[model samples]
Target chain A: MTNADTLGALLLENERTRPTKPAIREKDLGIWRTYDWAEYTQNVRDFAMGLAKRGFGAGDKLCVAGNNRPRLYWAELAAISLGGTAVPVYQDAIATELQYVLNNADVKVIVAEDQEQVDKVLSLRDGLTGLEYLVYDDSRGMAELEDDAAVLSFEEVQADGVEYGRANPTAFADAVAKVKSTDIALMAYTSGTTGNPKGVMLSHGNMVRTCRTFLENEDVRESDDLFSYLPLAWVGEAIYSTTVSLMSGCSCNCPEGPETFRRDGRELGATGFVAAPRSLEMVLSEIQVKANDASGIKRWVFNTFRDVAVDIENRKAEGLPISLGAKLKRAIGEILVYGPIRDQYAFRRARWVYVGGAPLGPDSFRFFRAMGINLKQVYGSTEVSGLVTLQSDEMASPDHVGKPCPGIEVRIDDNGEVLIKSEGVFQGSLKMAGSALATLGSWKAPDS
Target chain B: MPAASTAGEVTLSVSGVSKYFGGVRAVDNVSVDIPKGSIFSIIGPNGAGKTSLVNMISGFYTPNTGSIIFQGKDITALRPNERAERGIARTFQNIALFAGMNVLENLMLGRHIHMKSNLLKACLYWGPNQREEVRHRARCEEIIDFLKLNDLRKQSTGALAYGFQKRVELGRALALEPDLLLLDEPMAGMNSEEKEDMARYILDVNEELGTTIILIEHDMGVVMDISTRIAVLDQGTKIAEGTPAEVQADPAVIAAYLGTSH
Candidate 1:
């Protein structure tokens, strides 16, 4: 919308507009470190130049495997800035499972978060003949491999890139200018329960258009804080944390580690939240446990107000008018129970919270809504760049996912299967020619 | 007892050390020379005085009859605090971390010997004191990252699982950055997976940091697999001292500790 067609261009735009604004924050060693937009762009540029110095360019694949860390996000943008596609492997994936995805994606360069991921990748080195460089962010427990020819630290690569940039001043910008909007940006692998995971290739145009359209339909703000705790391998994370934050100029917060998510989430008080159904269930379970362990009077107050909130939600959903007396009671309940509960769970500033990836249990869905969280269900998959339909704010019931996103068309076919047609629809799956062609033919033209 | 036949310089030398608890001879004339940068394991059956010998070396119990030299200095008369200052760190068989403190705080407490600021200076919190605090915190963070304790760094030690508590103890000991480390059963109550993780961390400390480790564990498989040299004790007396292969084949060690089936 702003003449920035690709994600790299959007990043450059953010740096030009708000150079000093905090673009990302990561909690490390019990302290939150903020990197402004100017710094973020500098990191992306240096890493891009570094990759370019090593013969990485268009059609190459760079794999990022690790938890939600700021360096990993920069690595993703660095790959894209060099006109190469970024493939994120799940951090919890075992060695053999990792081997399949690495081989299938034809990854040439890898940016591992720490020694754990580096070890996993090194274990499969025999089969990964295509991989040329192994870069790691944290160097702890890696003293033994420092002299290896194939391995390099993140700082070392950046330093090399700095030297290269000095020699060729405009090399990074030139490469970024070469990245077309229609170029493949991300390749995410499915879970592969039935077979090997398929790589869904989404173009820069696909991701940028989808995020822009969703932002137009929603109230996401430039001042919002988005928490990036989900696996980067998921399409939802790619859209929400990486693309959406880059486009909207919001700050993305990454927790210190997996165990610190709850504490860090509370500290950041993020304005945007996205989680799968299982994570929503975990939140509900935590609240229930805390409520049960509360003092007698506090528990009584919680249970009573919870019922009131649920009653109000149900009446509102069923199109029943609330009496003035009931409205007064609901307002009092919000002050007494719902407000504190929301604050405790770090939903106080949450303007938009979504639960997707699967249908949430009705009880858990209603429970969150009752606590004053606008918990909405989204329905989509990796094939659609993570957005086909989204529940509106006023839609409270979990019976169906809300209407289709702006400019997207969804229709049921003869076999009772859903078909989506939108600009966000991915180009095709990599290495599966038959299914890729079949998928392209299945998307019928919208009945304009 | 035969001398440890390793090639490196001896980091800790215990010559005919004996600790007596009233009438019970907890440790009777035990001698072991632990080489630098080696994983030295001490194995024995119940009541074999392995812990007693470790307690004497760590200065919790002074040897009644023998002198202990660490890094070429006799430390037999030093107190526990003095020994800790001399680069000796130990983790208990039972977790002894401060129950109310978080993991980071417990590990930070391990750096008490290294802090130079007095109570008054620390209370003022200016200049040198603040820098000292920051330095110690950074060291604690390194240990946290090394032991993979990032997730539990802020959780209370008492609330952690048993295996995690043991790991936290190990982490606290590692925070000392000692030249000689004594682990008196770091993997006592862990399942196989926890045992494997603890064993890996121990080897990492030995190989990566080059700390001299004297491990007292009951798991024979772990002891045999990771130890550079083995010392077997029976009823407060040294029975065999050699490499794992030599100790495993020794008839006296097999009859005393490893059963006939082993």
Candidate 2:
């Protein structure tokens, strides 16, 4: 067993160091409900002890399918802390698609969000012989579920842990102590757009090293906040929300739902952000639509400054020095248009914004930067533990994905395929490579 | 619904409370104990006297019989504004936001009781009134953030969407920072999404703010999802009172609402 520290251990260390600090917040009913590190750690311990009492130990796979919720994150840490591997499945997966992942992983326990997901698992319950428990976060409408023994509410699991803790006083600590760094921590399934999804096995060390390295390269502080509406199953979210945020003791905010992201984001004034290219496009389109509908003078002011912002962004990207007059014009543009737009989009406090998961359009990329948001492109895959190349602020062009992150090595072969070697690399899928494609020197400009 | 845990201290109690509107007995003899910091839902079909019962507790109507107790103190004779002063606030089934006022202004009006500025000092717009105005506005802004109404803060309440107008009414009630909040069909006329949003905000108010909520909602799904205890009112009589799960399974509740076998 590798003695290297696990992500769960690092989280415990963070708890010890900053127990009262805000760890995460979620928009509930209309309020940003906060959870401190001490509460977060206790929740994880409760889940761990509860699952442990249920005979979930070494080699057990706990399948978690849900939206971004704090409990889901705690479940992952709890599973990993006791030598169990967490498998986060996409919440939107259809029954047939979900069946494949569950059966493939041979999941022992399932922690689903609500009745919709519970129904999916229950429909396939007969086929999944290995499945033991179905723990649902939202127990609404679940009383009608036929299999009483097979299902338990999320609160019941935590209560079980509390009972277990009282019965065997040292049980929680003993279970946590049994976890080793080499243990498989998580199995994230890639979104199978064209074919069957493959599971990328990330160990505790891999996750901790990658997230720590990313933290080192970036200016992540405890004061930094993240609005995490992304899917927890996605590698990016796992890295940012579950791993790095814990590593840095920063607060992660979750929107009430998909529809409330813009409002929640503005309310949070989040400092760091990670999202897909599609979301960026949506924001761009939303801005354009609203700006177009404005009165004549307002539209004119926005359009004129928008041009100035574009010019400033172009100059910065080209590494050309800005003229005194251009700088003055950009400063005025910032006050007139850019600043308010950023505030409206909840980018007012954003120090770093990452766009990944699919290639982003250059126009959308430049648009955010033009609004004075420190937008950057992140290039990596699930096999790399979600960190490879991060565009630095100095290498501010949208055309080229910047230098590789700290402790990561990147190489290009004669075939023009990108090969990466890093501590963050998954234990499996060692030969994972992406073709450079026809856009070699023009690599920076993603497909619009 | 099974019985709610008798753990929470009873914050409000209505013993044999009944309201009569002229010849019609809008509410028959009813008794309910709302536990502190729990969502107590009053649900029934229309004309079931659910609203009438709520009106009695919120001081909108005088109960013709029996008495009401809050924190063991009898408040049966208190007026509506007087009840609000004693930490009771309410929202109407139909939105009651000031039509001429913007969202922020409407919310500020909710803080009127908290403001102690006399007209003599207020005429100069300086001194205690100025400080009080700033303080009240700041409190309203906090409610605005809590309700995610930053985008619509300056818009007139009448010009807003039905969903947003409902939200604004909720915001105004929240501005009171009440200990006991009476919501009258808060989710009525709202779409599913709007209902969900309202339900979440209500939950937040109950949990985060530690406010005891007496909710009147017809949306069974939302009521079941949020309410710690539920009372089924049918034909001006209390049919069932218990937790959501228990009430959902109750034969009497099913007969009255979901329909009888006959």
lDDT over C-alpha atoms for residue A436 of model 2:
26
Tens-digit lDDT string for candidate 2 (A183-250): 78999887545567777778888788888878778898887888888888888888887787877888
Residue pairs of candidate 1 with colliding backbone atoms: none
Candidate 2 collision pairs: A29-B200, A29-B201, A399-A444, A400-A444, B1-B245, B1-B246, B1-B247, B1-B248, B2-B246
| Candidate 2 total steric clashes | 9
lDDT for position B29 in model 2: 95
When only the first chain is scored, the TM-scores of the models are 0.97, 0.92
- Candidate 1 lDDT by residue in tens digits, B185-261: 99998999999999999988887788889999999999999999999999999999999999999999878854676
Ten residues in sequence with the least summed lDDT for candidate 1 chain A: A439-448
Q: Docking category for candidate 1?
A: acceptable
Instruction: Using lDDT, give the best candidate's number.
Output: 1
Evaluate residue B115 in candidate 2 and report its C-alpha lDDT on the 0 to 100 scale: 81
Cα deviation at A362, candidate 1, in Å, is: 3.8
Q: Write the per-residue lDDT of candidate 1 for residues A1-448, one digit (tens) a residue.
A: 4669899989999999989988999998778999999999999889888988999999899999999999999999999988899999999999999989999989999999999999999999999968998999998777778779899999988998999999999998888899999899999998645678899899999899989878887788888889999999999999988898899899999998998888889989999798899988887888789989999998998888888888877888789988897778879988998898888888989987899988898878888898889899887778778888888898746888889987988888887667788778888889888556335534532221
DockQ for candidate 1, C-alpha atoms: 0.39
